[model samples]
Target: MSNSQQSLGDYGIDIESNPESQDRQDPHTIGILGSADDYAPHSIDREGLPNINGFDWEVQPVQYGPAEILEYWRLDGDFHDGLSHEKIPGSGGIIIRGADDYLREHALTEIEVPDYYTRFENEETHCRWSADGRTHISWRFLKRAVRLSNGYGRIDPVTTRVILCDTGHLFVSGPRGAFLVDIPPGRIFRNGDDLPEPPDSVYETIRGIQVPEENPELRTAFERYFRLLSESPYPSPISHAGFNGADHVLETTSEKTVVNDNNLKVLGGQTKPFEDTVGVYSRQCESTNFVVSVDPMHLPGEIGEEVTLSDDITSFGSSGDTTGIITGYRTNWREEDHIAPSSSGVSTLHFNLIVGLIMPDLTVTRRRINVATFEP
Candidate 1:
């Protein structure tokens, strides 16, 4: 092998088709189309390289207009003895005479996600964000895989891949951890009430979407509500009658409080401990009556900070299409009385919704942080 070439067999990836970035065209990537040509060998120097015809190769251009190149990986090999290569067009069409130079780069190691990269927004086209590249892939890919593969995305760390979760989440060693960056019906909790209809984003009443029908627990867990999603949504089955069903959104019994920081002193009033139902549900809402606490607040008030009922949401019913519980879940973001670092007195209400039956509750927990404000 010349200094420009490597043992292609050593690397398990094939250049003809990149399973990750091949064929599929997203708004950011239209698709990949590469080609190569014959470059006859000349007089051999002791190591059999070039005597002339200087081998050069590039990725053929496909009307991408102009691009701000981020990052790219290259592969090099010969089917028999010809040449192959790829490139980022400065403007358009790629130019390759042989395969030697292409082999000099991009044929090894897995990608560990660079700190900066771009990703397209889930709902909008032509809109991209400059963020930790990992955040972009982590967010959209999961939703994409889940939507495409029957509502779930698989992450295999061993293979450094996040796939749709049909074949048992793929790889034995799942890829890096995945996060829930966003969720649908995002604004519904502002009022804390279940609507007779889901938001337009939800699009329609969910008919029997592709959820599993075998597992008794998972089946019973979904059936009714999802079936109704095919019809319409409801606060409680008894609260209204309609088409399409609803996705599961549960009520939590966690401590939530309204705090304000006029960019100065953190101000908030505290209620008696565990006073969740006093005047929460009936208070006020622009759209809905509740907000969800991913992790409700629980703090040892030595720092003039406390957790109270930010809002109260109840479930409707208990049987058939009606979940029996009146209402559940929320999304209230009143300024924090005080925000702390993850080291001392943190005020974040981490809410975790464990998909369950009857009372899909949002469990709130807090981490001890040491955050404080500054002054002149």
Candidate 2:
């Protein structure tokens, strides 16, 4: 009998010497078997099966060759594609680029990735995947290194510029341009009181000041001045001089004038010469003399009430202060002869007040004045 026909009495099985029979029985075999002339010495049964245990196997029919088998196992489902340096989300870790490029982009120096392998002494395996395959990387090392390199926990100093606008608006200028923000009006105190309204011209001038990023000092100073103006109720006068590196000077002038009715005649004399002239000219005489017609009803006292013109006349000035007095007064009547027979030929009464003044002897001198009633 051929070797294929051999019988195993212990195992109650027949041995097959044919290669095809051996191949067919390979799936059923689990342990080492006796060597045969057709089988290679290094060859083993179940060569294609998985080495792991407790795996569920499913057999599906296939018409081509041997039945196809599929093996299934449990997986965590957390695996994902590796991330590129630029594709990493969020800010913190240094980007994967040259030092110069990184510095230029972030305005800071390059920071190295953490080396957890060298830092930790534990037996735990820490690794990451690279383009080629799995690689070793310590997240803890990288996080610490990045934190240190980036100054992650420290507070960075920031420079800001504050500007006060004349429109009662407060502007804050920083890395960004001046931002008009609504600031509480009373919150800004100057000289222990609320700030006053700034002139519109001041706003226009400040807006004209060029604040380029290159000149930080000048920009900062401008901002500081703005803040000072906003906070103080009475800030030091701000002018073009301050911006031009000169001392700030304050100039104030009267806004209104007060005039006494008694001074009307005096004002008429001083202003009479200029009534016809177009251009400005100085008076040649020390005192001006002029005649004024007065209404009977406007006279300070009753008719026939003998009163001094100087006592009845009060000086009027633009600043609400009396500046001069009425010097003289008289009354005259002239009769009109009408040729018309229907006319009654009534006489017209004229009351004239003559005003005279001596220079450098005035009791009250005013910077400005207005006359309410005067006719010359």
Candidate 3:
């Protein structure tokens, strides 16, 4: 077989409209356009990839797919083979061309996360700090997989270096170079108490929207909410409603602390104890109440012991006022309170979030370096 043929068949992914595959997946196509003529023999060179954020990323080349497949991968290009191949982002691993390929896959391997990365605030987009003085970075890891469509439609593990940034940018190293994953833009609803009503229109409440007929009463409430949304001026009502719902939940629930993987912190107070925890400066505003549940095992003092922020801990650098006292430590650590490292073959050391004070000026934050297992 020629190099082109070898490359295409090597990974067991076929772009051509196979009769058998077509019959099976008639309703949903993998967004592949044109024929074999749209594909040209392209070899990827993986040498000299620059180090991003102080770590050398070992990026894998695009295991040759037709140019049209790039679009299915949400890459920024068209189906023309004549487009520049010199600048395709390294795929880090094999390409799973489409949603059909994703469905056919069997299992996914947990993504190994890079330790030395930070999710800081982009003032243009999000808040600068959390209720605590520390900066919170939103991030999560997912499983990577690929499927062989032409073969027995077998699923196999593949590496796709997916990095979630704080500024709502998702970078995936795929068929092309590192490209931004497209996410629908959302407007932030700061106040949960006030939900805006939808715009006025002459349609029954959620008239066309599909809801389960079994739960008429529940459906009625949903219709009421949908009516409110239908009358709203927001372009993306679903996304807007989601944000509003979260805010509403926070408002109604007694547990005002919104702790998730994104905002969870391991305030070890002293950073030297945990190799997986990195110290960061989080913001602590006067208006927000800074409270944390302490895991005493990670703390230097007893549960009731009051420690001065400046004199007791080295986690938050010496820049802020250290006179603040952290008292009434509550040992309320949950399962999701800890974080582990992401790189391969590291004896997994789980680090729990520790209790620390929201100092007047300096609120030190520590984040987990490990990537969480993929959910879907």
Candidate 4:
């Protein structure tokens, strides 16, 4: 068989030797042309290829989805080897990209945190403070995600370093900068014996006077009196009254009245008797007396009369002879004594007396005096 005829098997077709079978089976067959001009091939041009017809072949600009966008900005040649970002599921238009670079440049260092304290995952838009409680860091991207998915996209943990101020407070570092965190106070355990005792000087002891119970009424009265006296700016006198008194005369006489008569008896003549009075004894007498009495049925008028010294005297007749005038008088009764009969049922009366006395020279002298009396 000729080479072209043997290649028919390669094309998966066999030519029939019978002309009638060929006509029946190969109905669409075209007859060979007698000349090359009768059958011409289509032209093959390079207009659509690079550097063909003066055209410069280059990669076309294309839009990327959320995941591919992250890879593009990552700048890593290996697209699958770096950190990636994606939109949170049902987050609407929010997107985050290039978080790995942001955290690597700005986040707090793992060495700065103690092993006891946990370091949170470096997810986009998330932040954490160092264990030393000084540096603050966070990261996020503004680009919207082209694809929707739950949570942050697959992110690889990145090592970060931060220089923090020794403020003794929690802080985080991020692209924006470091900021303070208000950490809440933590509870601490303690033992009952660990409590401290108060100083002895802080405690005080008070001692009170023990009063006898036998005379409670007297004690109460005294206490009331003392309290009233302390509160009063000027305490009133216990008793005040007015009265008058009679003044008495004093006289002096010679010791010898008839001594000369005996010495002249021998002279047979009676000697003149010697009688001499040095001064006259005539003087105005004034006297005053104060009397206080307690009577259960005592009338108010009686008390008033007694204090004023207006009580009638037997010597002073019904016409009433006034020997002396009263200047002032005051009376005080112990109410407590009346209320509590066990107490002293005593009333006080004071009398002030003004008296006129005649001296040896016959000059009238006036004297004023005061007296107080109590009765029960």
Candidate 5:
């Protein structure tokens, strides 16, 4: 437990190549770069599993420090262009970091998107289809660390270079993407740590999704992360009802759907601490909130049923001055929605519901709740 820290390469992978030296003595062992005394050796319960690598990966908590931007590359037309650390206007990476104030202070702020890229629609500009549309876009990946705090003061940070692009939204990939929100400089917390409440810079939700009214499990889970009222006017996407089955309860159409469906289930409302982009965190309200796209055609339900509502739904409504519901739906045709022609036909008609969700000290969260495809 008191072993001295070992030297590891830039990304924490040991790059030692001397095969005959003690450095490679444990051929199957992977080393982490930090004082071994800082963490307990994370053991894997491999009782029924075969030894694939002959060793399991260990958890080593790296020292907490200020965020740093080591390099940047120009992801030009389709990104085949080559890599350069030289700063180019209009283009910047996302910043994923710990929710801690110290790390947030040290993280990089926003960089504008180049006029050429920004002028073009986000859908057209963000993809990797260069001239011929058949070439593989090159990427100069770098490992960046995401900081995590136990809320009580213990801090741990981990590194990642992976991003998952689903349908159209971008996610941090791996465990990091699990509990993300559009809050600038996304905040991640260790399990059981009291998560910070919203309206702060860290607790926004995916725009269009709302809490399920009948799902005690989901509403209970959502309330863990957001503040909701019993008498609120807005409606929740019904999931499951007890005996008299509810219709059009928000359900995933398929088991294979990735981002939206899976995002619905954050374990115990716990999120792994990390941020998404590569620089100091900045809340690009347009970009971050703009990315999440819910499918309009195959809206989730038990089968082929549209949502049931006796009243006409607007973008928002008022039950009273202090309380009402807010749905995650937004105009499918925002100015930036110029990528594909099919997108023009997607549903965008739902009430904002947030205007009425006013609470005295608690910030109202527009929880991501999937609604039926609107046909006008």
Candidate 6:
């Protein structure tokens, strides 16, 4: 996309649109963005999303190669602003690509928010707002192909109407605003008469939004592309969790809720591949782990109901020392409480582990909701 080709003259029904003349601007809109702020609370650029505590990584275009594409779920973030990318796997028999290595190389080796993408990076700054008189902001969760890989890819961005590049630049319209359009140097994102709503997924949970489909003439006819799938969903994250039912063995908090019991009904456990983000040097961590945020996975039992702990405590991650009980040996999606992609047909539980000299022993525990109502 080029800036020379498209101009401010052609914006769409959603997000920002330069109304030709300054007098035509809305009272709340600010045509120009990226200026010094004075009225906002923090000194930061008053971005729409939370503060980005990260370092920019100039993709080692020469030394580092694009991550070997695979068949696993992953989080692809922007090198500039933090944005979550979920996920895919690769070729060459190697399962875990640890795609985030690109970030670690740039010095992002911490895990603040337990997101499937950065389980260390920032939230997707992928949307912007253009309120009249209000300073406009444009943040993009770039779903890009940073590292050129050497293997076969499972998901490649399909050639659509728009000229999809290695990067998926999301054009935002701010809170509950419009998003998802390419923003290259010469490309002018034309808000289609019909934009499509984003399908619900872990990415949606991370971005904290349900992206709507465009009006029509959706994407521009792109000539070339690199990615398997390209998308930009408005984020709507649950920074907290609610607690209900038998409050006997559950710990509740604003961000998350934990329920534990001795008699958890056993479900299933299987081995799955993942790109670990915790290891320091090793490409493989034997006991590496991952944290997942699941939906209404486990069937909540009645208050004071009984459960039977399953034997298999299943867990999956990379090859390295684990510090937490990422998983023991148990079924992932079959149990409640654990994350299950939330997308249709995907029952795999996402993982995030802490690496150390010693493996963080985990127990992928599971239990039935109501033993009293046990059935065959």
User: Backbone clashes per model, in order?
Assistant: 64, 15, 14, 22, 28, 99
- Error of model 4, residue 55, in angstroms: 56
Q: What is the lDDT of candidate 4?
A: 0.21
Estimate, for each residue in 279-359, the C-alpha lDDT of model 3 and write its tens digit. Answer: 322222333322332232344443222344433334324554343223212222122222345534322222234433322
| Two-way lDDT contest, 4 vs 6, winner | 4
Best by TM-score: 3
Candidate 1 TM-score, C-alpha based: 0.16
RMSD of each: 22.9, 43.5, 21.1, 58.4, 22.5, 23.4
lDDT of each: 0.22, 0.24, 0.26, 0.21, 0.22, 0.20
lDDT-based ranking, best first?
Answer: 3, 2, 5, 1, 4, 6
Candidate 3 lDDT for residue 337: 23
Model 2 Cα lDDT, one tens digit per residue, 1-376: 1222333323222223332321111211311112111111121223433232222223421211111112223222354234222111121111111212211221101112223324332322121111111111223333322322223233111312222222222222222111222212211111211111212212223334322111122233344333332333222223322111011212112121221222222332332121222222222111433333334433433311223333334332232322222222222222234457896754332222232221112211222111122221
Per-residue CA lDDT of candidate 4, range 186-280, in tens?
21112211111212221112112121111122223223322322333322113111101101111212111110111111111211111111112
- Stretches off by above 4 angstroms in model 4 are 1-165, 175-177, 190-376
Task: Point to the candidate with the largest lDDT.
Answer: 3
Model 2 weakest 10-residue run by lDDT: 127-136
Please say which candidate is ahead in TM-score: 4 or 6. Answer: 6
TM-scores, all models, native as reference: 0.16, 0.13, 0.23, 0.12, 0.19, 0.15
Please give, for residues 98-147, the per-residue lDDT of candidate 1 as tens digits. Answer: 22222111111112321112331222111011000111122333333222
Model 2 TM-score, all chains together = 0.13
lDDT of 6 by residue, 265-362 (tens): 11112111122221222221224333333222232222112222232321223333222212122222122232457735322222222111111111
| Least well predicted 10-residue stretch by lDDT in candidate 5 | 128-137
